[model samples]
Target: MTTRTASARYDGMGRTGKGHITTQSGILTDQYYGFNTRFEDEPGTNPEELIAAAHAACFTMALSFALERAGFRDGTLETKAAVKLEQSDGGFTITRSDLVLDASVPGISPDQFAEIAAGAKANCPVSKLLNAEITLEHHLK
Candidate 1:
């Protein structure tokens, strides 16, 4: 099995209670990484934005795989995944993920494009990670 590891160091005198987020590969990126309620539900960029980025990238890859597998000849494909964070019964939930896709497959019909988009939407890695319900509003144009 393969595992991906990333680490973050809380910046400051270790008392500031906040720090910059980094990946194992030395990628410096910050996510929603602090106490919310203690700071009016806001301090640093939160998990939702990170989740949205992950989902968008993952879903795009999935769509690419599906397209190649379907013998679409690997055309240009782009996806915009919108992960909606909403207030729920207790905490916030990612209530919806809208995948807007645009592809240029010369021989594939619109129905086939939609099918591939749908499949990718259902099987994306980020989609699998979330415990909340997912509502995919996909448009393969």
Candidate 2:
């Protein structure tokens, strides 16, 4: 197990601020993300979208490995994670993360696929790390 790192910097305060985010892998090198991107839907990325990407990637990889261990090697799993950010009395909070998966696995029963997918959804590292509510909806084709 290893540690991963990312950093962000903001140049101003509140809605007028500009920020940049960078990751260890350099996938996001000085990528812009700030008030406009987050609240106003301007160009660039945001924290919620980053969380969604992380969740989707982690869950899909976990399911791929689980399927391999279950003796089903050949399949395609496409997972999309939507993270919800809500504003309430307590300020802003990430309320939920919903995962929708489209899977194509040969020679597997619907029951078995559902079971495995559920297990992956429950046990994936990102899911475990999240403090918000997590829901998984999977479609097998």
Say which candidate scores most in TM-score.
2
Candidate 1 deviant stretches above 4 angstroms: 9-17, 29-44, 137-141
Query: Which pairs clash (backbone N, Cα, C closer than 3 Å) in model 1?
Result: 11-19, 32-45, 32-46
Q: Model 1 scores what on Cα lDDT?
A: 0.69
Model 1 agreement with the true structure over 1-118: per-residue lDDT tens digits: 8677766566554335775566666654554365451235566654566677778888888888888898876577776766677778988667777666667777888888878777
Error of 2 at 70 (Å): 0.4
RMSD of each: 4.1, 0.8
On a 0 to 1 TM-score scale, where does candidate 2 land against the true structure? 0.97
Listed per model in order, the count of residue pairs whose N, CA or C atoms clash below 3 Å is 3, 0
Per-residue lDDT of 90 in model 1:
88
